[model samples]
Target: MKTFIAVLTIFLLSLQCDRFQFGSNQTKDDQAGAVVTFLQGNIFITTQGKESKAKIGDVIRPGDRIITKLGRVDLQTYRGEVIRIKDNSDVLFRDIAGASRQNTDIHLWTGNLLVKSVKLKSGQNLSVTSPTMVAGVRGTVFSFELEKGSVPKVKVYEGAVSVAFKTSPKLIELNEGLSKENYTRLVKTLEENEVVLEPGEKLEVNPNLNELVYLINAKVATGALTGDELSGFVDFENGLSKVNAIVSPQEKAEVETLVSIPGETIQKQIDSQNADNTDVTTQTIEKEHSEKRIEALNRIASEAEKTGLDNEEEIHSHYSVLETIHKANGEVLSGAVVAQLGDIFIVHSTKGVFQLSVDDIEYVEYRNFKVKTRAKR
Candidate 1:
C-alpha cells in the first residue's frame, strides 16, 4: 500500500508537468500566424493537407493556404496589421513571426489583396510573392494583384515598396569560366533590376524576364541574338525604371479607400443592431460590465507583475481576463482582443476567434496593458 501511494504521487507530478509543457507549446505556436477576423461568402483554409471552409478565429499558420471564391476575408496579424483578401483570390501563408521586428512572407497565387500595414520596427519585413515577381515592404499600405497569364502589378498608397522579378535558377547556374566577362555583366544587371515605387506609384513586372538565362539560351539557340545583344535586351526589359506611371491622387484615394470598407460596414451593422440599446437599463448594464472588465484587467496585470514575470510573460498572463464584447444584438462575447484594424476588433474568445466591428459592439473592455474603450457606436 505504501509503495503504491508513492508511485501514484510521482505519476501525478509527472502528468502535471507534461500538461504545463503542452500548454506552453500550444501558445507559442498560436503566435506564429495571422488569425481570421472576418469571413464572407465562401472561403476555405487548407492545413496539413486538409481543406475546410474557413471560419472566424482560424489561425493561418505557415504552410496554410486560403482561397476566397465570391467572398472576401479580413485577417489581422500581430500589432493590428490587416490583410484584406479580396474576391477570387488564392493566397498561402508561407511564414510569419509575431515577435518584435517581425517577418511575414505570403505567396499570392492569384487575385488581389489590400494591405494596411502597421509601422514596422527596424529589421521588420513583409513580402508578397507570385510565381514570377515579389514585392517587399517595410511599412506601407498597398495593393497587390496577380492574375494568371498576366503581369503582376503592385500599387503603393502610403509608403514605398520594392518590386522585382524573381531570380532564375538557370541564371545562377551559368558557367563563370566559360565566359567570365559576360557572366559578370549579366549577374550585375540582374542584381540591379529591382524597382522601388513611392506613394501613388504603380509598376508591372514582365514575368517572362524572370528566367534570364532561359531567355538568353533560347535566343542563342535560334541565332536570334548574340549574348551581348541579349544582355542589353535583358537590361532594357528589366531595368529599374518604372514600367507604369504613377497613379493620380484620385486614383490613389480610390485604392486606399478600400481599407476602410470593413470598419465602415461593421459600424453600419452595429448602428442598425444597436438602435434599441438606448434604454436606461441597457446603459446601466453596459456601464457596470465596462467597469468590471477594467477592474479585471488591472487585477490580472497587477498579479502577473507581482509574480516577478517578464513583460512578455505578463502580457500572456493577462489573457486570463476574459474580455467582454457586447454585440449590437442582445448577445455577448467573452474573449481577449488580440488585434485591431481601425474600428474592427479581432477577439480570441472562449467560443473562437471573432472579428467584431466597433459599430456592432456596444463597447469593448480591452486590456489594461494597452487599454482603450471602444465607445458605443
Candidate 2:
C-alpha cells in the first residue's frame, strides 16, 4: 500500500508541471500592447528573432518591429493613439503602455509616418527618433519623413512639439497656431539661433552644408516647391552656380564657349571633319568637341531620369496584377485591378465587383504567387 501511494504522488506532481508549462506559454502569447488596425501588401511583424505575416487584429507588443514593403499599415495603440506608416517604412515600437503610461518612444529607420494623438494623460509623453533628430510631444498630430541621404523633415498640424538634434543637446519648441497673438508670442520666444516652426510650417534639419544642398536639389527635382519656395530654390541654385564658376574658372570658360556654338553647327563640323581627310590637329579638336557634346547630353538625360518620368513604363506594368487591399476599417480583400475611373478604383475581388474610393483604402499591394498546371502528355 505504501508503494501504491508513492506512485500516485509522483503522477500528481507530473500533472502540476504540465499545467505550469501550459500557463507560461499562454502568457507569452498574450503579451501585447497594441493591435494592428489596418495593413495590406507585404506587412510583417518581427519579434524575438521570429517573423510572421501581419494581419488585422494582430497584437503588437513592445519591442516589436513592423516592416512594410510596397505597403502601408495603420496601428492603434491601446492608449488610443493612431500611427500610420507609409510604404517602404520600418518602425520599432520601443514601448507601449495602456494604463497610466510614462513614456513611449518610436524609432523610425526610414520612410514616412503620420501620428495622431488626441491627448496624453498626465505624466505621459511620446517621442519619435530618427537617425538625425528627435521630436517629443505630449499630444499632437504630426508627420515625419526619413528619406535617404536627406535630413529628417517634420511637419506639425496640431499641438506643440520640442525637436532636438541627435548630434547635439540643443532643443527648440515648435507651436501650432493657437491664435494670431499667441503665434506672435511663441515666435518672440525663440532665441536668435533657435528655430520655432509655426503651424503649416515645415523644417528640414542638416548640419552638413553639402548634404543640405543635395537635399534641396532633390526637393527641387521632385517638383516639391511652389510660390516663394520655388523662388528661394531658384536663388539658391543660382548661388551654387556662381560658386562653381568661381572654383573652376577654366571649366567655366570652356562651358561658355561650348554653350555659344549651336548644336547644328557642332554636328555639321563633326560631319565635315569625318568626310574630309582632316589634319591631326583639326581631327583632335573635332573629337574633343564631339565628346563634350555627348557628355552634356548624357547629363541632361540623367537629370531628367531623376524626375522619375523615366520609370513610367515600369509603373504601369503592374496595374492589372492581382493584389491584396488593406482597408482602414480592418478589412482585407484580394482582387485584380479592372480599371481606374477617376478617383475611384474598380476591383474584381473575391467578394465580387466593387468600386473603392482611394480615400477608403489604406494600401494595395501586388500578390506574389505562382501556380503550376499539369503538363500536356
Candidate 3:
C-alpha cells in the first residue's frame, strides 16, 4: 500500500514542473481546420474537460484527441506526426507552443507511442520522459515506447532525435526517420518510378527499422547512384580495414552495414555485443563520431534543434553514426570516404589508424553529440 501511494504521488507531483499546457477554449470549433483522422485504432477526440483517462495498448492516429494525464500531450500538428498510446497509459495536453513551428509537449504515464511529424522548427519540439528515458525533438517524426524497465527505448521513423539518460554524452544520440525495410521500399519505389527496380515495386515503410538504415537505404534508392557509387559500396571490403583497429574486427563489420533490423527490437544484440570494449579512447571517439557518420546526421540534428529539447536525448538517438578510415600517411582518401563521417566525423589520415587514439587526433570537433554534459543531471 505504501508503494502504491508513493507511485500515485509521483504522478500527481509531475504536474508541478510540467510545461505542456492546453487551453480549454482551443477546442475543435476554435480550430475549425484541424481535422482528426483515425488511420488505425479507435482514437477519442476530446476537449480539456472531456478527456481524463486512457488505457495501455490504445492506438491514436492522424487526428485531434483530447488527452488527460495532466501535464502535456503531443500531437502531430503538421498532421504528419503519428503517435500511439499503449494500455494503462494516461496523458494530458494543455496548449501547443505555436502554429508556425508546431511545438507540442506531452506527458505519458505508462505505455507506448509511435509519432510521425512533419519537419518542425526551433522551439517547436516535444519534451517527454519516463523513469528510464527522455526525448526532445525539433521537427521530425518518429515513435517512442515506455514500459517498466531500466531504460525505455525511443525510435525515430522519419526525422532525427537526440536522446539522453541512457549512458554518457554519446547516449545523447541520433536516430533515423525511416526503417530499413521502409528504406528498401523507398528505394524500390524510386527505382520503379525511374524504371530501375522491378516493375510494380512499391514504397515500403516499416516501423521496426532503425533510422540510420532507413536513411542509407533511402539515399541509395532516391539519390542517384552511378557506377562510381556502386563501386563505393564495393569498396566496403577494403574500406573495412581502415576502421578495424579502432573497433573490434567483428564489430567493425557489423556497425557499418545497411542491414535492416525490425521495430519492437530492444537493440539487445547491438547492446550486448558492443565489443566488450574497454578502450575508453576508442569509445569516446566512436560515440562522438557516431552522429557524424555523414552529413545526413547533421541535417537531422539541424532540423531537430527547432524543438527546445534539441540538446536532449530522445530525438537524436535515432539518427547518427561515425565513420573512421585510415590510409598510408600520404595517401588521400576519396571524398566518399570523408563523407562517411556523420556527426563528430573524423578520418585518421595518420599512418595506420589501427595504432591511433584520441591523443593522436590532430584536433576534434564535436557536432550533434556535444562534449558538454546535459545528461548527468
Candidate 4:
C-alpha cells in the first residue's frame, strides 16, 4: 500500500504545478491578448493589487501590470506579435482584446520596449504611450524607450508610426472668433495631430515642449495672447525644442518676439543653467550644436572629443569596426549601432537616432562590443 500511495502523491503534485504555472482561471479567450512566451529573472505580474511571479504560458489580460526588476520578459499577443519588455521596466496593459475595444494599448510608465508587430486585421490598432509621447502603429517593428532624465524616443524599423506629444494643443480651447482663412489654418494644424514616421525615421519629443505649452496657456488665460497666433507659436516651439535638430541663432533671436524671455534664456532654462548662470552657448561649442544621441553614441563621441581626431590611430585601436549602414538607394548612414532586436537595427548617427530594417539596407558593417553596462533597451 505504501508503493501505491507514493505514485498517487507524485501525480497530485504535477496537477498542482500546472495550476500554479498558468493562472487557475485561464481560458482559451484569454490567450487573445497577452500570453507570456519567455521570462528571465525577477518578473512579476500584478492583478487586482496582488503580485505573483510570472511564468511561461501565463495569460495576462487587460488591467494587468508587468513589472521587471532585474531581468526581461517576452509577451506574445495574437497573430504571433511579440513585445519584449527590457530590464528595469514597468508596463501596463490598458486595453487588450477587451469586449468593446479593437485596439491593444500598452502603456509604459517607465523603461524600454522592443515591439515586433504583425499587420492587424480590419479595424484593429496597436498603440504605445510614454509619459511624453504617444505612438500609434498599424503594423510595424519599432522601439520606444522612456529613459530617466532623457527625452522619450520612438524609432520605426518597418511600416509607419504616427507620434505626437501628449500635451499637444487642443482645438476645443480656441474659443475666440477668427477669419475663415485663419480658422482653416488652425484646424489643419491641430488635425495633423501627430508626426507620421516612415520606415528608417525616428523622433524624440523634448520634455521642455510640455513646459512651453503650459507657459503659453498661462499667457492665454491672462488675455495677453489670442487664439489666432497660437498655432504658429506652438509649431515654432515644437520645431526648435526637439533634440538632434539644430536651432539657428536667427531663429533664437526671433523667439523673443513671441515670448517675454529671450530664446537664449529659454534654452538656458532647458539646460537647468549652471550655478554661475553664465550663458551655456558661449562656454561650450558642443552645447550649441543641439545634437543628442543615445548614451552609447555619446560615449564614443565624448572619447573622440577628448582625444582629438589627430590621434585617430590610437583611438581606432581601442574600437573595432565602426558601424555603417548602406541603403539600397546608395545613401550611407554612419553611427554606433547600439541594439539589435531581430532584423531591426537601432543606429545613433550624428544626424539623429534611426531604426532601420535589414530589408531596406544593401549591407551593414557593425562592431561587437564587450562593455560593463549597456544602454537601457
lDDT of 3 at 79: 26
lDDT against true structure, model 1:
0.58
Q: Write the per-residue lDDT of candidate 2 for residues 296-337, one digit (tens) a residue.
A: 444433332343421213223323245787887889877554
Q: How many residue pairs clash in each candidate?
A: 2, 0, 72, 0
| TM-score leader | 1
How do all models score by TM-score?
0.52, 0.44, 0.29, 0.48
Expressed as tens digits, the lDDT of each residue in 345-365 for candidate 3 is 323222211222334434333
Off by over 4 Å in 3: 1-34, 39-46, 52-75, 78-80, 86-88, 97-102, 165-377
Q: Write the residue-wise lDDT of candidate 4 on 90-167 in tens digits.
A: 998876642234667788888988776668776667778765556778777777888776677776666787775443
For candidate 4, what is the TM-score? Answer: 0.48
C-alpha lDDT of candidate 4 relative to the true structure: 0.54
Query: What stretches of model 2 exceed 4 Å from their correct place?
Result: 1-32, 168-196, 207-377
Off by over 4 Å in 4: 1-31, 98-101, 167-193, 212-236, 239-377
Residue 373, candidate 3: C-alpha displacement in angstroms: 55
TM-score of candidate 2 on Cα atoms, chains taken together = 0.44
Position 18, candidate 4: lDDT: 29
How many angstroms is residue 160 displaced in model 1 relative to the true structure, after the best TM-score fit?
A: 0.8
Determine the backbone clash count of candidate 4. 0
